[model samples]
Target chain A: MHMLLNTDQSLTQRSEHALKDSFLRQAVQFTTERLREKKEESTNALGDWELWRERGRQIRAHTIQYLDYYLDQFATNVEQAGGQVYFAKDGVEAAKIALEIAKEKRAKKVVKSKSMVTEEVEINTVFEKEGIACVETDLGEYIVQLAKQTPSHIIIPAIHQTREQIAQLFSAEQGKAVSTDTKALTAFARQKLREAFAQAEIGMTGCNFAIAESGSVVLFSNEGNIRMVTTLPKTQIVMMGMERMVPTWEDLEVMANLLPRSATGQKLTAYMSILTGPKRSDEKDGPEELHIIIVDNGRSKQLGDPKFQAILHCIRCGACLNVCPVYRQIGGHAYGSVYPGPIGAVLSPLLNPEDEQVQELADASSLCGACYDACPVQIPLHDMLVYLRERRVKTQGGIEKVAFRGYSAIFRHQATFQWMMKTLRHVQKWSVKDGSRWSSFLSRLPIVQGWVRSRRLPYSTQRSFREQWKMLQKELEEGVDNQ
Target chain B: MNREAFLLHLAKQLGRPEIRNPPKREQIGAPDHWKSFVLPRKSERVDRFCQEARTLGAEVHCFETQQQLQEGLQALLTSLKPQSILRWDHTECPAMIDSVLNRWKSRIVDPIADPSQALHADVGITTVDFAIADTGTLVLCSDEQKSRGVSLFPAHHIAIVDADQIRTRMGEVLAEFRGGKPPSAIHFITGPSRSSDIENDLSIGVHGPAVLHILVKV
Candidate 1:
């Protein structure tokens, strides 16, 4: 049931690999820091950020609460606008639908702007298997595709790659040596992707927000690749998550203000293309045939579950990722999902709670609440992590279960807890040395070996709190005669 | 699954077998206070727009009349020395500039007989639908007379905007769309095309116009 289209490495293994790559760790930290600072500055400049965040949350909640109504409205409007809408239950079906469209177009090549839903469905593999050349038009996506890797960051997909690596990737693609200069690298990609854009019969883009009122698909990009994807090809396909809908153009104004500032610290990206439908009969450019595939792909599972439904309210701004401390340290590869960071930690599991590997991703957070604070829509991801851990423990009983049960049994009885504490005090004398060091190195061997391996176990005080309280009370009773 | 089955399944999962009618939206757009926020004076907005647009790497020029706008365009064309120019077929654009632009191989992009001509042109100019002073954005709507490629495909884009058309915020521009069906395409161009994909280095003009100039007529 897991729809993650990345590698199968466990969270621990991926984190270990990421930790060893010093460059990746530094790059992730630096970029996340930059994004976080920009978000802070822009939000502060805008003023009333908390009020706007609340409005965004309210809008998302309302839309998702009655998603059926909005979605039906959106589909009908799209149809009236002369576009077709398809609903897919899972990744396989979504990819098959896209492939079917491509085949019907007799497409030999397809150019795509960056779309996380496409990655989730593994759509490129489907197209490639069908012998259609699928080209990633976004610069970051183009680099990652050349290296045959999934995106490591949401906004900046190639955040894990250094400039030197990108130069090599571009050189390999161009069959010539390319310099590490940013301008040179960008020019090369522009030239390379220009051909793809010109020759491709079908173009694909990910919808940032689908305006339910007008049936318009809004795309935000700094590079304008989306503009090319929507304008240059004859047939256009938009793949979107089922929850990526806003009610009206008025609501879109709120999202337009929030998403860019939270994502890249700009009032807006360089280009925000709002395509209502395919080309009108008199228009010279734009796609002639437009198809929008709304993919559920496990999104429906969150609808009724009260605890996890808020996960669908996310706007994919990556603000939570930038502020996540663990994500800063381990980078996106550690999550091992198309989405990475705090959102990924909660979303990957909720999307497929039955998969052991996906369930284990919940353990990748520190529960520091930074992500919750950073979230523009205010999804309490830290609480969701705890809930996931509780569910996991309930389903797979372990040593933690026995330990908690024993502790609860002792604590439920006052006398038993007191007796246990007294007994432990005597037993600690054998382990604790005279001056707080261990009496012998071997004395530290038994109970706390795992805990003390990386940290010092503090010596417990000889007198417990109850004993000290009793002695103080006796002293107070005798103090009247002495005075 | 078919669309009907899909909607039915979602409704069931949501625990509401029947689709709920749209709720009464109390707070549809921005907050009431934001809606009532006062816009700056026309001259002040124009000044602020120039500053903000420059901050985002776009050049801005202010003029008081069509004659000044024509003179400015002529000077810009002389300095840049572009090989060819493309202008949108909008009446807001001054007709006299066509003479200045005629020195080079120039064409109006109204009935775009060939799309590649605009794509290969050295410079493309269009009169914008509206300008946002706060974000320094220009809104362009595509129609029979306005080709989307005129603003997108060229190396340099010069947008002629009237001072009165500038609004204070993005919400103000979007509020206009509440009345009718949107056009085929509406693009909000903030600045020159840019990408920080290569190690977070900001490079301009990756896929679209490299330089964007806002020529404002007061």
Candidate 2:
């Protein structure tokens, strides 16, 4: 997480690094564009997409409203199924529990499936510090791990890596020449991961949805790493965001419809595994001992709060990221958190409130409502981004506060508003350079620069729309009087 | 660790204000229009649905007579060359099929026999009580003959569904579950065990079955 910190390197500097790499830019753009196209095609294929979104929203809202009941029921079921449940208040506590579990197991090696929660808690770095070997088993995760880099996209972790770079990574791992061919590269990854799956002392995964009634953590994945992770290892630990719960198997059908279609435009995930408590007494292949860590880590704080509560409904589909202009251009690295996109813009700031590192993340959205349109659950992420910005202003003692104050002052007095408009008309000349306007100057000026860098004002009309409307209305009224 | 303390902690995290019972939700699952989607005859619909399921990568077989179903089972059992097979609790399948399999040194047992044992078995045979035509989902309820782990865990899973049991919508089968929650476990299987994890490479059979054969009997 410290790598995410060091605001000394702002999103601009990081995005600049990503932009300069032609391969990285092409790869990210290709994947995001392909994913966006798939989403459009799939949503159109599924008639009444809006109805599905609404049903999804209804279930999420209902489940969140009664989270306590559902979470308790889920916990009871997991326990009854012979799984231990631990509720962590925050990342520190979550990491602490993970470290303790590792120590208790005397585990020298751990194989992990792709889990954003693990990244949030910085578990790999923690294990590294403890001198435990942690290997990422997911193919995308393996590429990033080889590069000593964090995941750049939510669903496609190595979206930034080109085929050439992957070949290079694999070549170095093998200490021999490796082909850049996709099949050969993938086969290499399979061989490497198959070894890790066989030998790892502990297997860890993220929970997609936990069925409270059945004490089952449902995992949806295209890769079979999660299955191998849960079944082959002796001990399996599932780290679930506290809100990743549904009332029953009945609710799972709704989520099943929404998640895969939203994530990758699949009719259904290739493998959807429901693990009910470690291995039952009669079970042969599943984990012998199962531990489910319900990590709150700033999620419970959103409960009942009307303004930001709907943010919890996110199934982490990555559809929002694919459609987001900011994510499409700057890529996920700029967000510098486990999550990225419109969802990340709100989630990161909310999760790490007041941490100067993520405070500016809320400004990354264009708020065009494209994300809301793309969301399977219809979470109004654009509105949530605004709420995060509002909350940030409410808490800060500096430029954000002064910026809002100046904004409010302009609107409070009509004279000041008109004066500011006139001043901005004269001041706007310098911004228009050779017909293409320069926006970076406006952003670099002060605290609000992040917003300016991402958006451009089309050449301002000769008169304000409000002024034109008033004049037209006045003329119409006078003509009527004359008649 | 203590139940009372855990409950208190969980309750507090829920923002322990006075308990307010929220309104009961009516709108859940697929929309009403989807639930109302019905096909023509069960036999013809089952044939079309099985074909569709096969198109999505599941192996499908249609049997006209009970003897034909037994013949198909015999052929599959001989080809697999397994020492043991797991059978689900269902009356439609020939009772002698179990003894016949046992004679081949492939002993048959009830569906719920431990998953580990199921994993080691050559094949698992169960009669799917219900199937959905739309998404190619088979609904398995826990009973004396059917164990949740049979269709899953094993190298090969053979499911038999009476043609009349096939439905058009997934909801119709889920409603059967609502009547009294049949067992601790219920599974909806759509297609073959598949994975696209390694660079989007599609591989069949990772942890679950390598082959799934569904026999539709009229």
Highest lDDT against the true fold, candidate: 1
Q: Measured with DockQ on alpha carbons, how good is candidate 1? A: 0.79
Best by DockQ: 1
Question: Candidate 2 has what TM-score?
Answer: 0.82
What TM-score against the true fold does each predicted structure earn?
Answer: 0.95, 0.82
Q: Which ranges in model 1 have alpha carbons more than 4 Å from their true place?
A: A1-8, A425-429, A432-453, B106-114
Per-residue alpha-carbon lDDT of model 2 for A1-483, expressed as tens digits? 232554668766777876787766676687788777877777787688888889889989988877777777778778887889998877778888888888898988899988888888888988989998889877778889999988888788887777778899899999997897766776677667767776777999998998766778888765556766776677888888888998776778778878888887766664666677665555434577888888877776677678878888989888999989888888888788778888888888888775876878888887899999999998998988888778776876677688778899899988889889877876775655323455545656664465456655545647877789999999999999999
Error of 1 at A67 (Å): 0.5
User: lDDT by residue for model 1 over A162-273, one digit each (tens)?
Assistant: 8999999889888899999999999898888888888999999999999998898999999989999999999999999999999988899889889999999988899999
Residue A314 Cα positional deviation in candidate 1, in Å, after optimal superposition: 0.2
Pairs with backbone N, CA or C atoms under 3 Å apart (clashes), candidate 2: A223-B197, A284-B116, A443-A449, B83-B106, B88-B145, B89-B145
User: Candidate 1 lDDT, tens digit per residue, B45-147?
Assistant: 8887888899999998889888989889889887877766777765655677666667764444432566556566778888899999888899999987687
Report the C-alpha lDDT of model 2 over B80-116, residue by residue, as the tens digit.
8776677664565567566556666536643334434
**What are the Cα lDDT values of the candidates?**
0.87, 0.75
lDDT of 1: 0.87
**DockQ numbers for every candidate?**
0.79, 0.24
Measured by TM-score, the strongest candidate is: 1
